[model samples]
Target chain A: MKVLVTVKEVAEADDDFAIEGTDIAESDLEYDLNEWDDYAVEAAVQLAEAGIADEVVTVTVGRERTEETIRMALAKGADRAVRVWDEALDGAFADVASKVDLFEAVVAEEEPDLVLGGVQAADTGFGATGVALAERIGFEHAAVVNDLDVDADAGVAHVHRELEGGVEELTEVDLPAVLTVQTGLNEPRYASLRGIRQAQRKEIAAKDLSDLGLTADDVESSLTITSMYEPESESDAEMIEGDAGESADRLAEVLREKGVSA
Target chain B: MSVLVAAEHRRGALRDVSYEAITAGRELADARGADLHVAVIGGDVDGFAEDLNRDGVDAIHTVADGEEFDHNAYQAALSQLADGIDAGAVVLPNSVNGLDYAPALAEALGVPIVTDAVGMAYDDGLTVTREMYGSKVETTVDVAGDRFVLTVRGGEWPPAEGVGDAAIESVDVDVPESGARVTGFEEVGGGDVDIADADVLVSVGRGIEEEENIELIEDLADALGATLSASRPIVDNGWLPKNRQVGQSGKVVTPDVYIAVGISGAVQHVAGMKGSDTIVAINTDPNAPIFDIADYGIVGDLFDVVPELIDEFA
Candidate 1:
């Protein structure tokens, strides 16, 4: 079985993000693969390690920094990588529809048994790429997947979906499916010294829309953007004081004073 | 111009969030001088559609079919309807199911898409408000296009009201090729009330120490008739389930009363609950940021103060 995993680079969670004019402060912001996507890559590696799947290919759409994200996946265990390397993607997916067409082209060529992705990226957090690619390529898809186990012998994959109300449901589907892994799906493993060295020798494929036989206009935007701005500032932080017991009393009194509670 | 809003339902029942999306759409439509158009999917959603036929909506588009519930099929149908009606903008609830198809639908229709939108507007183009960087910052994005798709966050905008008869338009959508089949759906049931809808939420953080100590927080929740929630670390440690997690990576909630106990108010956790109507934080550290947005705060060790607070509320 062959697998395709979509990865992305996002500003690290610890980084301080600020919007300056129309653009974000990309300077001083350390970029890494989206944390949740780590689970997707790990799930593919585990499948290969268990001999339930044969090979894994990692795909990402971005500029030079995205190569780092793909490299991290390769270091873990993905067999190869493909980068779309578009500048518009750094801003938003809405401006880069051609990426979907490119993904569709690769899916047709690879004919993979399964496509996996993180439910949402830390940046933008649109969580739309997997579904968009799946729809464009005409494949079955599931979202918020917390657990996935492939029974390659029967050509079936069983997945658990996270739902509201602490409700979880087990669903089974056939091969050639798209599964969007949610956070906590599986613990991602760090790359071993040997694996890191081996990744340097692996193939990292590059492709563009022309190679996919699709033009940028094929997936151009239908909506127009007017402007982008930051939210207005609200009140600043209000500090409370005193020992545990005294503060609790003051809290109760304040709640009563605000008529929030009595 | 008429604004189009997709009415989302589960197993043929209109979801509460869809109403909120409609409320949001109605406001945008009103501002733009556009009539609202609601499109209801699923084989038996007409009955549900009737309940949503408010005054702002000019008509309801019904695509009643068994396959219409599937993401690709539903998205294809919506895409066709968007093209057929020449919709000004499409609205959806930024729910799990809606998120599953909204972007794909937008891509299929070649429209710009925005998810978890908290605000909306119409000028020369469509602009929306969305929280980013763990809710520490907000970004207002403007999409360039004639039509766009937006998935609204739950509770970001209150549900709309005022009822009148909306005209019905039965659209015949050709079912597109489907790649997935729902062999079955099982319901994973969380505890009684979902934290998202709860009026009061009592959440725990790492300072609780042991699992057994959870009972104290539970007691407080019981006293206030509030729901129980936790930070990601508490959930990650298995002290609470993922459903109860409150953080940027967890569920975003806008409850009426959110009480944080032993929580340091990490930015990630605060992003999920900061929209609450009233916040009360109880932590040993007086400097915890949770006190910033909190209407009331107690700088106390939860172990000593929780019991007394529970007794007072009880």
Candidate 2:
């Protein structure tokens, strides 16, 4: 079985994420593969490790800087990498870049047996791209999927979706499907130094929309970021000075004053 | 302007969130002076359609056949339904399934999707309010177009009331051949509690220190007959299962009473439980964000306060 995994370049999860006025300052932050995307890569790699997949292809949408992410994916064990490089892409749709349209364009061309991506991009956190892509492709889609098993011979995959009330529903579908891997889907493997060197020798395909017979007119951005600003701080902590028993009493008094407990 | 709300169900039993989404859609329709229409899709959803009509829905479009809850299939059918009815806006409940189709549905109609939406108002255009950045802040999103998709946050709105003579209409939306198929679903077992339905919840956070100390919180939960829950940190640390995580990343709950111990509330954590009737916060830091929305706050260590609270409740 062959699988296609989608990756995104996002602010590293460890970034300070300072919301200054309305703008999120990405200037001081380091860039890396999105945390959730790592799970998608790992899930695909696991399929190979389990001898369930014959090939795993990692796909990313970005310009030259994003190649580093693709290389990292290779280090994590993807057989190959495909980067759709558009220098004019500005990460916004209307004038520059749009996440949904760009992803839809990529999926339409790849047409893989299975597609996987992180549930949401950490930076924008729109959490809609994978679902949107699935819709555009008219593939069966499930989000927040923590577990997946595919029947290679039968060309069908069963996905375990996390739902409210601790209830899970199993949806079995054919291949050429889209599933968004959530955090905790799998423990992502680290890219060893040896793996990084091997990635340099691996093939990474570069493509454009025109080559894929797709057009920019196929995408549009509905929401606009009017301004980015930092949120005003709204909390103040008061230390209760005492040992366990005394502090408990004082806490009780506060709760009572606030009408929390009689 | 006509409001379009999507109905979600498994087999034939409708999800409670559908009622909430319709309530939210009803609000938008009320503000826009339009009728509210619900689109019910599944293999067999007649019962769901009947339930939806009880909410005073102006019309119901029941699209049956195929595996009922597939997102890709739902999006295509919804897009067709939205176009056929000329809906001003489409609304969805922000569940895993809802998030899957909202953006795609919006894109298919060439509109923007306002996700995690909590409230809506219509003026010259439709205005939506949503929380961003883990609920550390609230922002209002206004879309200028007539057709858009909106996914309402869970537990944000009350379910729609059954008050009108709204009749159910059977609308056949040709089921497109699904590119993906559901083969199976398995449930993860923790069995400690069902957080969404709990009347009272005792949630722990990073401040609790070690996993062993969780027993203390559980003791308190038992005393009050409340469910035990935790922030994403606890679940990430393996102190609890993923289902117990309460934040934008996990389940959202609106219990009647919520007691948070050792939890320095992050915006994401608060976004999940801010709807609780009464919030009592027990944290060492007096200035923890949990105290901001907390009705009763105890500025004390959970190790000290939890035992006493448990004993007192006993």
Candidate 3:
């Protein structure tokens, strides 16, 4: 079985984020592979190591700098890396529909037995891209999956989806499907020195949107941001200042005032 | 124009978030001067529909099929229902099932979507308020297109109340062949001591550091006569069972008094227990976001404070 894992390069905001024009400033951002996608990469790598999957190809949509993220995946054991970028997608990062369009094109090119992605990006947190990509590509999909077992011969995958209220739903999805993985699915392995050296030799292919036969017009956003600002602190919490003992005593007193403690 | 709310249910019982969606849908409908309609899809959902007939609801549409939630059935049924009713805006809970189908439904309908909306306003078009960067920043998004889809965050809106005699309408639609079949639900954490039932929650976070320290939190819970709960890390680390976890991916709990120990309070963790009446945060970091929402904060180490707290209560 071959697996295609979609990774994302997201900006980790500094202590403060400022909106430059319509979006956050690039300077105040430190970019890394999305926290959730690390789990997706780990899941794919585990499958390959267990011989359940013959190959794992990782892909991402970003500018030139995003190749670093794809390389990070390769270092974690992905067989190959592909970076999908287009000038047309410059500001299209905020649009799930457009991102889905680009990802669908990538999936068509890869033609893997399974496609996996982080349930949502750390930055945008859209959580819609994977399912939308699945819909656009006409594949069976599941979201927020914590556990996955693939039966390649049977062409079905048994997955455990994390639901609210600490309940998990066990579902069986037909193969050639897309799955958005949840966090804590697996502990992502650190890139070994040997693995890093091997990744440098691995081929990292780059694809433009035009190569996928998609135009900027074809991928347009239905939602637009009107304004961005810091959320005001709703509560003026009373901070009890003192050592551990004094603070605890004051907190207990406050609790008593609130009728929470006798 | 009609605002359609997709009611979420499990085994024929409506979830609390379903009512929250209805409340949000009512607000959107009123803003647009449109009628509010709810769609309940499941087997034996007539009772669920009847339960959804709250004030501001104009109609209840039921599709009696699929005992469990199937993505294909929900996507097909909701899109068909929205199309049939010419829905101007569709409101859904930002839940596991709702998030699963919302995007595909929006795509099929060719409508704009704003998900995880904590607040919303409609003036000619919809403007949704959402959190970004772990809820540190809030963004107000303006949606384009005449029709839109929104998934309201749970606990943001109060449940719809009062009574309304909504006309029940049964809709017949073809559910497409599902690519996935739900086998069954397995309750995590042994289905023991539901945190939702606890009036006071003694929650531990990553600051607890190690599994052995969990006994310290357990002792604190026993001192306060509160139930023991934890953040995702503790559960993910296998130090505590998954049921003790509280957060978006875990359980939304509204205990009367919540004491967060060694918790920095990420938005995901806060989302679960923010509804607690009195939140007492014990973290050494004074800048921890948990302190922002805490009713009373102790900027001290939980290792020291918790034992003292336990002794004080004793």
Of candidates 3 and 1, the better by lDDT: 3
Top model by TM-score, which number?
3
Docking category for candidate 3? medium
Judged by DockQ cut-offs, is candidate 1 incorrect, acceptable, medium or high? acceptable
RMSD of each: 5.4, 5.3, 3.0
Task: For residue B11, give model 3's deviation from the true position in Å.
Answer: 2.2
- Comparing only chain B with the true structure, the TM-scores of all models are 0.74, 0.78, 0.86
Candidate 2, A178-244: lDDT as tens digits:
8888776777889999988999999888877666555665444555544443345544435455666
Per-candidate Cα lDDT values, in order, are: 0.74, 0.74, 0.85
Off by over 4 Å in 1: A13-18, A86-96, A206-230, A233-238, A241-262, B31-33, B169-177, B189-202, B205-229, B232-239, B242-278, B282-293, B297-314
* Model 3 lDDT per residue over B1-314, tens place: 79999988876668899999999999988888889999988867788887889998999999988787888888888888888888979999898888898998888887767789989888888889997766656788888766888999888899999889899999987987787999999877657678989888889999998889899999888877789999988887778888788987788899889989998898778878889999999887665789888988888878888888777888
Ranked by DockQ, the better of candidates 1 and 2 is: 1
List of clashing residue pairs for candidate 3: none
Per-residue lDDT tens digits for candidate 3, residues A51-122, read: 899999988888898887778889889989888887776774357787777788888788888999998888
* DockQ comparison, 2 vs 3, better candidate: 3
Q: Over all chains combined, what TM-score does candidate 3 have?
A: 0.91
Where in model 3 is the C-alpha error above 4 Å?
A16-19, A243-249, A252-262, B191-201, B208-228, B248-257, B275-277, B284-289, B300-314
Question: Candidates' interface RMSDs, in order?
Answer: 5.8, 5.7, 3.0
Worst 10 residues of 2 chain B by lDDT: B131-140
Candidate 1: Cα lDDT at B205: 92
Model 3 chain A: ten consecutive residues of lowest lDDT: A253-262
Error of 2 at A89 (Å): 2.8
